[model samples]
Target chain A: MASPPTPLRAPEHQVAGHQAAEGRLGPLVDGAGLFFKPLQGDGRGDDEVSFYTLLSSLPSSSLPSSSFFPSFHGTRLLPASDGSGPHPHLALEDLVAEFSNPAIVDIKIGSRTWYPQASEDYIRKCFEKDQRTTSASLGFRISGIQIRDGSGAWKPDRGEIRRFSPRDVRIALRRFVSSDPRSDPDRALAAAVYGGADGVLAKLGELKRWFEEQTLFHFNSVSVLVVYERDAGATLGKGKVKVKLVDFAHVVEGKGVIDHNFLGGLCSLIRFISDVLTGLDENCI
Target chain B: MASPPTPLRAPEHQVAGHQAAEGRLGPLVDGAGLFFKPLQGDGRGDDEVSFYTLLSSLPSSSLPSSSFFPSFHGTRLLPASDGSGPHPHLALEDLVAEFSNPAIVDIKIGSRTWYPQASEDYIRKCFEKDQRTTSASLGFRISGIQIRDGSGAWKPDRGEIRRFSPRDVRIALRRFVSSDPRSDPDRALAAAVYGGADGVLAKLGELKRWFEEQTLFHFNSVSVLVVYERDAGATLGKGKVKVKLVDFAHVVEGKGVIDHNFLGGLCSLIRFISDVLTGLDENCI
Candidate 1:
């Protein structure tokens, strides 16, 4: 699918500054916690508004529970929007608060419209590369975010606010894997992402199918959040590690370039990650 | 711990009759769906009253996400409880409703106060026998119960409301395990019960520790509910099976023989099931 032109929007610097001012009391990412779209003409762009509506309409019971996305709490409308200043805010379940001793790794997958064309091409090429015979970066990026711990204290993990490119992800994963030979990090990672099954790739493929079946356009990139408890006893447990998908700002639905591209791009990205996870040769990727 | 004398209570026929009259609009078990204790002097005896209080006071977040017990929804007090005739009830998320093809097996696992001394002695002997050498019944019985389904409909399964003995569980589990060759039914069962860690005994030991840590008493017979999704693909997946503990009708607090007996009996029952699951040599059970 051909990529759609990056839509007209405020430059990143300006948007970030504006969002910082708007969400001073909220988290660093504006609307990152949102599960619903504020009503139309609420200041946010049309694309984001549409995305929230589609996401919120999904029945929570129908969705399989995964750690890839934070379990969404409902949306609350602050005093604005309906009038001149009121706005809607989403309250998400705090990730760290759910674990005994949490270690979270957030990787943003897929191409972003905001990224330069060259960077996007690089990611696409990496996704297409063969995994069995080659050792290369998976071409995704990682970011760090602070979440409150079980004690209600905010703690910033190592990779929290800035995006790490594919090279960064490989390096980080290698370090994490190498840090503890006893952990069987590859298997743990696989279990966290696709659950504990022998055929990790097949399960991920099925998950991708479920995603595409939703018919949601993906404009913004998708973030893959993996959380694991550092407790020694938890290393091999099935529920100890979780993988969740988050961030739906650029999603929409229709038989459009964006929708098709989202599915294709995500499928490629997932396959790439699966290859990295299953292929036993650590140096091979 | 010496077995506590069975607390004086109404005969089964009379108790059932009173419960039937009390729960006109509810299920056969008066508090089958309850999360809170009904107020005193309203009919339920002291044993049940204390059990509900202890169970309800538990912080849901502290409980590990397990399939054995139905996922807990919040508690609700229907009208009349304030001074009228309404009662408090627990809303639990349905297991069958959560999966595509769900099969639930509820096993009531501890000895009852009403058990004859001979039956109790047999149970004790089974517990003392080496799992590797004994094929004897663990002596505990399992009774099934009905629960709400995903479609908001109450469906009674084939074995629901019926009791199964150790022989029954063994037969059922053997059938489930034999039906799928690739899944290594024994390991799958262990994972479902204790979240997929090696050393099933160790995991159970840890779970027991968690239970004891809660400082709550266990007087009521413990029920071990196992749920499995019969998806063709799920035959080999780790998360497809779940096990939970339920039925807090006879709980109390403090260090007492009843509480000690509940723990010991449950430990023996779990070991029996674990032996059956992990030791595939049928004659070794």
Candidate 2:
């Protein structure tokens, strides 16, 4: 993949001035906190608007030091119209090349994506963190399975690990029951995701969805199973909804997810609503 | 199995007054967090330690009001506790009668202890909650095939769902991984107490003894995968590990408890600890 363009960022000096005007609140990070981001908008000539979007995502009462970073921001983060900061201002060709390059976002085995690149050392760091923050910094994982596609040549699994908005994450987990292409990739993906677990994934979905639509507020039963990708050793989870279908002993399993999560009243409404529902920070683990 | 004397409990009045004084700082529950316990040396004779043990284990600041709801650390909860509170309670004697007078805890199914009289509703609640909170609760599920014995008799899945001390919860998961059968009924009870793969019970001692000396911290990545017994439903998630091992892509086929966990970090630590340690909780899930 081609190299990325000089990114644009806000002037650190401008942000610092804003912070002086208003005070921010408690640790923007939660109990077990981490550094955080926001999704950028259309990358056009309007560098200020793009800069505004990034600034707005920050958890601060006032604007940060005009210098978002020590030396970069407007010139690199969003690419300003005029050349100001470090690194020879990137050319239009340079920006386009960077935009189209796979190298811009290195994808780790197991379809996980990384913005700059995900090195083995980096993957190791994520496992050490044991939470989603590291995961957000890096994208989802896509296992690199050794498969003999239509051709006999050996190739790495081509599944992608993109940095998705919370909206997309929600979209990937929803679905229909049958083998329809675009209608419900969740169902079809389950088979590929968990291999071919016939009833396991099927029952899981039916049960979870039922609880969401039925019994009202939060679920009575929930099951989250963590199964690693055998070959890549990538950590993955499977969550199920086990409802008391009838008697105390009987239950039904629901659908599964590589990125399992988000259910009724699992966390404080304040945190759940702010962190999970809103895509303020990347939710990874 | 005959009605064991209803275990003695401290008078509610005495404990209620003492609860708030115990230095715990969380919002007090009045009747919610305190417990009754005959003074250990008072000679009033009581063995209901599970209740207070669970409470005392809470972080000190919250112990005062947290004990009543022993399971409520109020951090990241999963779903519900099978028997933390409000759920119907069961005694060993009831389990025996339900199991045709055979010490029900003795019935073996692929190496797990299942008290059939125990509520499936309770067990399901635990599984669901665990997933939501930490996502490791599914480790409690049992296989369906051997849910019944050789003659096909059902079993009680949970003997008691009371909240256990962190120490106890840890011990419970590590149970029978390998301990000397010396007199403790907990050890001799076979599949009746710690449901696992059939003969796996006989080998628990070895697994435990090996890891106890080495599991010094949380990073050990040790865990135990014990199969459990469930209701007459189509599945309870048994034999999953074995089936998955056959082919990563193949769906699991069979019933009861299974461990679909990754062995890289915490999961690995549990197994390693169980393999080498002792004095852990008996009802962890």
Candidate 3:
């Protein structure tokens, strides 16, 4: 009953996921989401590096020190074990192989977030012969939202990304800020997007007015805030981004409130805080 | 208190909105969605035609149609003088030029959806120039989703189709079905994904299986039902699939829904039905 007509643009649902390897990873349902925090590939030594968790063929095994998932050079660590009971295990090599990306190099510097699929075994083997996830799971702070094709309506071969224009983001910002229009446009630009409740036609006018002005986004330690004015459509939708340390799933287990790595293990948001504080980078993890 | 440990994915947020465009199309947005339905382009009209609406100049005409978005071609009829609001708008030769989309085409086919943006000027022009929507609001079905950036972090410059290998699909499919060890593998396979209530991981596996098996669908004027098993993955987390339709916003608009021109929106399971229907396709349409 609380479903007040959603004004946000919908997520693309045209994806076809593959089956999970038996003993290695578990069964994958139609939609399995894994979150990752994009890590900066700084040249920190193993022990000096910060990350999330580490798995072991045995729990006592030491972690590699460096980050397994650098924004550039990523690591694929698996759960300590799989196929036991209430809590199964995830394999490591599978993680890296599944997340291998080929087209990352050709992306724009900082226009958006790039959340691709885990690579194929063949692709993974090409990069690292072992293709095994290491022991460990970490977490990160994401935009904290995931829209999946849980229903599988859209597909890549037969589907397409229609358009991402300024209006799309504009309307979104307006609808997001409807309940409480920001008094100071600059203070709550990005964060403003998270809250709103629009009425009928009358509210539409308020949203439209936002196009007449300019908007801004501030990403800091807390939540990111985006602020905008009325009728400034010229500069509302454009930016750059990356996946960081908190997004690592193997390192940290729980997500939002779900920690069932058994089916589709969640990528922890807390992982980023943990990694930043613990210095458990993957290379030496 | 009702948030399940692994609560289901509930998309109630509209990330990118024309917060302003709503006013432009305000009269059309009743409790239902757009008061018009886009007719599946028969390809009888122009090879390429784009439509635009603006928030400022919307005729503010009360919509008689309930939940129907209109579609327009080349022409204008004019608005009723008594409309709530009115505007003397600007003129653009081609909507796409204002949109700066020189090569865009409009036609709905296959398992795809679209979300194109229109400037207030262009939309206003459409409202004033073309009488089609002015007379009656029309609508378009989602043909595909557009992620501001799903390709390795939203780099519009790096235009690439994230592709999944056949092996990857298998991995995703197998992983999809491993959700329920209790139900019949085949029927649970059908129900777990296509039916019943399961976790996101299992649901993901269901979607993966649908793609690999090339399931087909059918609508009995009720809910959607999918049936397939050929290429279904035996387990989860294996194969090689590139992330397809990563942006979930489009799915909100495109997935699992069919529409009557200028009528009901986001009907249940259009994509799910398509998957089943495709299985019955001669060439795997």
Candidate 4:
């Protein structure tokens, strides 16, 4: 068995999913479901595990219920195809399958990415090099990767990681509003989620409140991945969207005052997204 | 030194406060000040110590920077003037001094009086009996004992503990709205804090959000004391009011799903108070 770990493979538990004949990312569980996380070397993964467990146990009435978080299955130990020893891996619900267009964006909130730092040297380096700013810019780094196809076969994804800055979002919205929905499915879908200026701003306001009011949200840093899809064959103005918060390695007990830097940064990031949506709504119509 | 603490007395350290010549609750600090808590057993006073310490550490930017909490002075070990050795007591900022006519009302929130169980047997008994309903009735048990008199000397308050059920509030408001403020000072003061029906309700909404958003409010039960004073000489309707949250013995760590029963009970209590204030506002003019 390999000592370290190996890349994720098709799930061993068989289910009648997609049939491979269609040459598509085969029959997936309803929704654009896809779960992929880098393996943890230290114990940060443990924190994530506990967080999911806590979330699962919460009473339904605790929050305004929605499918806000990805479901957690269990961990799996896979044996290398070469017959090496079993290595540990986490099994997470794939959210990509929930969408048709399946555009995903991962936005990180807060300045200090790692609290109770992995190492003092690492924290020192983070400060010395100004990684925070660099990390913000690195939002462009992730390429939309391949997903599983029919017959549990994985294939490369063609979707690109698009940056919806204020300007970009505005342009997208304008195009969406100006073009007939019947003629432009993609723009229509984007417009639906973006909501016209006021609607989009209102939704973002609610999201901001959610973040601020969440009782368990004590992590020094969190990455919120918004997954949205546009189905060309479906209604022009309607799109599927799901948002999931990830990276719970730094969750802390009980509320204390949130750091000003983190609070301000999170606000700015959300404002940027909101601005983009607003610009789109205003310019398009 | 007394084994158990005694009632608050004139501070050993003198400041230019009320000159006790005339029998009156003399000159006090301006701004809705008042702090009066029963002494605790089993060292729960220690929790208050830490709570104040934490509040003092918080930057001014947090919590909108109102005097939302009573300020804490240091603790003192006072030796009896008769050479009776020293006893520990807390030195808190006199909230009574904050108001010109400092009328303080203490409202406790939550069905659970203790968290993490101050005593196991007590918790067991609480569970065995439905104490929630009983606690609602317990509001009437606190007598409006006499407070300070001339010279800033402490005295047993003779005021009766008044229970403002929803109906009682309605009646109070009716009386307030109908009566002439020039003739009834007390009614006028109540009317001012209630802010007329609509204003009072709006303020309650804001207060609800404040409690929900405060990350540190994990206490099993919280007591909100609203201090208001009618500036009889200023205007018929003007009043100075401030609210403070007290009692940290049951404070708990980080956010988790709050108990539904507790949340529900809190809402009910606040609604009851809000209604009472509304009645006062509506009735008073």
Task: Residues A1-285, candidate 1: write the lDDT tens digits.
Answer: 121133212112111112223433323222222222233343333444445556668776535444234555555554332235545554444444445555555555532222222245653554333121111122234544322223442233433323444334444554333324233344444434343552334444555555433323434455556565654455445565555665655443422111322333344445445445655225433
Q: Which has the better lDDT: candidate 1, or candidate 2?
A: 1
Cα-based lDDT at residue A196, candidate 1 = 50
Q: Per-residue error at A202 for model 2, in Å?
A: 35
For each candidate, give its TM-score against the true structure. Answer: 0.33, 0.22, 0.17, 0.41
lDDT of 2 at A218: 17
Report the lDDT of model 3 for residue A152: 21
lDDT by residue (A58-112, candidate 3, tens digit) is: 1221222222222222232222123442322221121212221100100011111
Docking class of 4: incorrect
Residue-pair clash count for candidate 1? 27
- TM-scores computed on chain B for all candidates: 0.54, 0.21, 0.19, 0.61
Q: For candidate 2, write residues B1-285 as lDDT tens digits.
A: 121123323222211112223332111222323222212222211222332243346455532211112122212111112222221111211111112112111111111111122257754564344433223322222211112333443322232322333233343333422222112324433333334552333344333232122211111111233333322332323321111000011112111111112211122233323332332323222
Provide the lDDT at B271 for model 3.
23
lDDT per residue, candidate 4, A164-192, as tens digits?
Answer: 33334334323333323323323433455
For B68-177, candidate 4 gives per-residue lDDT tens digits of 56677656655432233444445566655634534444545543354443587865564333232333321111212122223342222222223333343234333332
Tell me how far the alpha carbon of residue A174 in candidate 3 is from the true structure, in angstroms, after superposition: 38
Top-TM-score structure, candidate number = 4
**lDDT for residue B83 in candidate 2, whole number 0-100:** 21
iRMSD for each candidate structure, in the order shown: 26.5, 16.5, 19.9, 18.2
- Quote the true-contact fraction of every model: 0.00, 0.00, 0.00, 0.00
